[model samples]
Target: MLFGAIQALQIITFEPLLLQCNLWLLAGIALFYLLESGERTNALRRILRVGVVGWMFGLVLAAVQILPTLELIPRAVRGAGFDFDTISSWSMHPIDLVNVVVPHLFGDPYTLDRADYWGESFHRGREGYLVSFFLGAVALLLSILSFLSPRRNLQRTLLGLTLLSLFMAAGEFNPFYRGLSEHVPGISLGRYPSKYFLAGALALAVMVSLGLEVLLIHEARGSRARRGVLAVAFSGLICAALGLGMHAYFQSRPHNLEAWIESMADPKRAAAKNFPVVASQLNQSLRASGIFLGLSSFLVLVSRFWEHPRMSPVLLVSVLAGELIPANLRVVPLMSDRDVEFVPEVITYLTRRGPNEIYRIVQLDSPLQTFSGIWAPNRSWAWRIHFTRMSGQPMYGIMSGLQYAVFYSVDNLNTRDSDELYGRAFRLQGADGLNFLGRLNSRVLLTTSEIPYPGVRVMAVLPTNTDRKLKVYWLEQMSPRAYFVSGVESVHSHKEALERLSQPDFPADRMVILENSGVDTKPGDEGAGNARVLSYQDRRVLCEVDAQKPGYLVLLDSFYPGWQAYVDGKEAQILRANYAFRAVEVPAGKHRVEFSYRPLFFYAGLALSCMGLLFGIVSIFWSGGPNGFKAVLIYLKSRHKKLKAKNGLLA
Candidate 1:
């Protein structure tokens, strides 16, 4: 369990918390059942105990990552407020529920040259859920049959879980979901509620297996076979009618189809060129659905006449494969291998820099616009613009050993600061905007469109012949990474510091904003100081500073917690300056200044994990075999009692 948790944290991109939440819920359910059973079965109790220990072990194993993440989340944008409309953007459509049986109702757009119909919505007009909720036609029928089996308790539990998951996946459509998001601590943190489909899928699988077993082992084989045949026949008729209705619906919506095809071809006019191709794919999907349902019905009918023990199971498996495999094939081609080596000419131009020179580059693509455009693409060119915004150019900076002024991550610790700086620099266009970038040592600006600014010269026009060319600009008069400011002004709040930064003659190079309260400094003390960076790394910076009198040395790095400053190996206070940058006070004289990241919580969590591991190992050796687990429990109980008694005495 510990190993699985660590791997999930590292690999899973979509929903990192889904697996943990499901496991926790399952453990709680199991414990509840064990307590309610009244038998107190040793086997059941042992299983529950093992589950609890495994969960604790996993939590301990991931404590280093978990601790910092918890501290950072509450301060993040998403965690600070819960937006219902934003969360509902990824909700599953009610009609998409039919995908559980027939997945290719709309042809797979990813694999096919073009889908019969397409929308710029989530999953390209398909369901937004991670995995299709398809349980196969036979599995669905069997799951319905499982309710009639003798295992009523198990069936009820599985059904309850499935219903609960589906309700959660509905997002804004379900009232219960809104309540859950409001009350549950971590539930609202999940961006996509459709991720709950994972729990539904698991429950469906278990129920399907139980249903299949029951159908294959009934005492009255003939009666059961007859019932199966009737059920399949009725379902087949319903599916055939639905398929025909869909065909008619598509025929009536030809204008929508033509518009979609035209958008793909020209992106400007509503004149369809590949109408025949689109029509052909739609017809193929309709025919395929009809044929699969017919074949499944025939197989079930044949089983009624045959009394062989294995015939029903074999036929069911064959029907399931036939129904599901082809639907899956149409979508498999969408996942093309990424060519990591395909660097564009514009990127190549920016990678060329002097060994000793350090500067930051700001990409002109607005993150706010990009996030908004992701959901609402009403214009023909919106798709292309959004794609460019979501590209990996910012990540390329790291690979090319260049510093990008803007950086984002799933757990963006410096989101508020970064957003403020980005908004001031790129979003607001003027001399003040230019100065904002200059203060952060941004020497280059990359843009998709022409942005004219003073002191910025066009460095290169990448792929000059192409319509979608990347323009690179060389910015002049940017500040150095580390600089000495002789004068300082104490600001009570971040708002005041930001307002000061916008002043035309703000003396950004001469003075720094010290956010600490009641700090006294002489305005006329213009000390002679020089600071030169000796070494620079991602989390650590070393500099040599010589100040004739007391002054402040400001570093143009995002002011984040856990970064500690040291002057000649002695610790010094790090103050927030210019709203997002770091500053440290230096006494008169030449000395080495170093800034290093040392997160206290991570180390504390690591130490606790180590101690817990040692205790587990010691308990195993002391108690011997499976009894070791019980011995550990006993020890914990005794410790709890002692702590309670000591608390009482203190009280």
Candidate 2:
């Protein structure tokens, strides 16, 4: 029960890709159980039954988060899976294997400027998906020693898994991984193939522990010692040769320290111009790694000469601590509150102006601006602002807004409708784009570039310590969060609506574009309607609408599942409006409308979870006072036999 709950909790909190790790651990447990059992056949069957049942129970326990996620996946951009090129990105290059021993050969992204990271998968200010994959020189040597130990079968299994993980980590470079990603069912769902390196790292750690046990406790002295020394010597020679080659390559670059330092100030030029710094760091890392390697190798050789094998643990621990601790420290970047905390004047300006108003703001600056300094200027300030959701390029949530006029990258978590609308909205710049922005209820736009559109007031020009200046523009004709639209333009489908939106004169401010054959909630006067948002909360929104005749009350929020609309005391159907927003029909008078989020899947999942909890409790408390599983099985068998007899009598 505990195993099932823990596994369920892991899936609930993190990506489903973590199931791969859980599977590996489960396989290990099964193998250990089989190895220890005298009656292997019976043990295998029993353990398999228990494991399957436990896995199923885990799914039930995780149903709460899982069901909602399952509902969302179909609407998500990556629901089906990613393309091979996208999924295989951030794969570990075969050349990056050197980093296992010489960590800073490519340079550190966190400790130094991200530009200093001269490695693969560097794009849009992100140096790499993974920065480091160092497993220590001592760990590597000990892992080699594990192969020579008596538990050759276990060692072989470890070696196979470690190699397989490394091959998978190679991703695009490996033909096998490429084939698997194309043909396999779930392989394409995972991104960043270099993440598989963690599995290899885990395997090596286990191997090192086993190797230490063989050396210290088992005392494999003569032949094992000779083989270990030979293996370390051969590996050390190869690493030394690789280091020399790298040194020669870095040596060819021009070393103009002052010039490189000056060029590092420019974010765009930093990566190319800062090669000298990277080269210098590489040289230092090489020297330091060589020293550690030599020291550890020396200790291993001396341990063979030492009479007492018990001292082997001391030397092993010392070598690992000396090499690994410093590498660990160097890879992690520490920041104080001053480094992360800052509020820009633009945000302060927005907050001061009608703080209670229900509206959203978009930051139009490029995400690469984060590379301007050690960190992005006032990036964390986005968290403090209410109603206004701010982000640059890598928008997190579904409602991070159509901040960018055109998404330059495909990293956004956008619906097909919103993506189409935003893409076309960029082409419809000037008046049309402004109208669309107004329809989105975008009141303020903070950008590095200046806006040249009409009715856009220059709110402020925020000067920062760097060369860049943030220009804040406020839209004068922007609509409120909730408003009554007298004119509702109906189309057959999202495709048709998108085609219509692409036109030069799409009047988004005066009318709402909905995907339907005909709109019934039309006002008698076509202009006798006014609506305002009474209150806005995370899960609910209240609005008051006044109309001379029946009309549509449109809310400029995402038309998502689970949100229900009610008109006064009666339930109302929420309609999809303005490509991806929500709307409901209101009668010909003043009335209050409420929208509350209460998804069916979430409630169903909760019920299932409660049932699971009850079963867990009953299993713990009942079933013959001891051996709960056996008692439950016996009760199930008796019930099955009774049901069989009753069916025979009925027949």
Candidate 3:
């Protein structure tokens, strides 16, 4: 139940990629159980049965989140899944393997200046999925030692998984990954194949633990212990040699060193101050790898030479800590409280506004960077790919509307709730695109560039730390958050409505484009009716509409599943208006029109979760002995068959 909750919470609160990691962990456990041998077969079966039951229980526990997610999946940007090129974009470059032992082979941005580091992908206008794949030289040595251990099944399962993970991380570079992506059900659901490194890292950690067990139990003076020591020492020599060789190869030719620096994304940096720092980074990392390996070798030798049982474990732990501590520290960039406190002037101006009305803000320049890393294939190239770091340079001055109550129409981070039809309307180029923002109730536009369009007034121009200034513009033509539209244009589909909205002449404020027919949108007084928002919450919105004549009360919010409309305490059908917003037909009188999120799928899932919880409690009671659950299942099946037979005779 806890695991399922964690998985569901991860999917809801965090990126789906994290849930993939949890699935991989489950796969590893299943593999471990499947590889079990000898007289433990019956025990393994019982354990597997419990695991299966627990898995189902977890699913039921998470059904509330899952059901809503399933409903949203088809409408989401990635509903159709990702193409091969996109799925494999951030795969680990084969050369990144050096980081397996020498983590700083690619200079860490955390430890060094951004321009000082030169990773492989950045030159190609791409960034790696992870900063480091360091498993520690001690861990690597133990993983190697596991091959010689007597537990064949355990060794094979872990090592095989580790190897497979490496291949999968290779992504497009590996034909096996390509085959798996095409044939495997869940493989295509994930992107950035380099993330598979987590599985390999986990497998190696487990193998290290197992190797430690073998080392601790064996006689220090025994032949097996000696062989293990020899193996460790030999592996250290190889790591040291590889490190030295990398440095030596670069030093062999002046052009090799120059070419390496020149290949960086920033050519000016390559020629200027960053050249020497970039050149020495790899060399220093190699030397450090050699130093670490040599130290591990000495530590292992001391553990072997010493007769004490605790000596081996103590020294091994010390060696592992020595390696891991520094590497882990470099993973996170050190920042002062001042840096955290620093807020852009533009952001400060926006957040300091009165809370009377709710409207969205659009960051015109940095739409791609919105939500941090949610990318869609259908998204325009102007909305840059998430993998590209723009040559390690800061692209935008202020990432607006990320956290504050200020919402953004185009780039606010909620991925599933985004309506593609409305997105398509906004993604239309030139003036047509900016026009759609008004329809979305976007009042303010935060941009680096000045808008040439009419009615877009410059509200404020604040100087930023960068070369560019942050300009805040007020859009005068924007519609209210909730308004009553007199004109309703019925369309056949979302495509037709989108096409109509794409035209600059479309009066989106006074008119609504609804896909559904039979809405009693009686011709309203063009300028008579008024709608005032009484409340606007995340899940619910209440508006008082005084319609002079029956018309549509159009709410400039994304029309999604579970949002119900009510007029004067009576339920009313909400029409998909203006490509992606909600529309309810109001009568020619003062009426309370409420829009509330009450998804049936959520309630259905809640009911299932309750049932599952009750079933789990019942099963716990029935689980009287080791084989009691199995016996209960057998009896239930027989009883079901007998009841079926009696029903058939009655029929």
TM-scores for the candidates: 0.79, 0.83, 0.81
lDDT of 2 by residue, 138-212 (tens): 787778777667776567667766886788888888888878988976678778878887777887888998777
**Per-model CA lDDT versus the true structure:** 0.64, 0.69, 0.67
Could you give me the TM-score of model 2 versus the true structure? Answer: 0.83
Q: What are the per-model C-alpha RMSD values against the true structure?
A: 9.0, 7.6, 9.1
- Better-scoring candidate (TM-score), 1 or 2: 2
In candidate 3, what are the lDDT values of residues 80-149, reduced to their tens digit? 6667877787788787786788766566553212445666444243336687787777777767666656
Give the per-residue lDDT of model 1 (tens digit) for 77-176: 6556447665655665565576666565444333122323342243433324454555556567657656655666777778877787788777777777
| Model 1 clashing residue pairs (backbone) | none
Residue 574: error of model 2 in Å? Answer: 1.0
Candidate 3 residue 535 C-alpha distance from true site, Å: 2.2
Residue pairs clashing, model 2: none
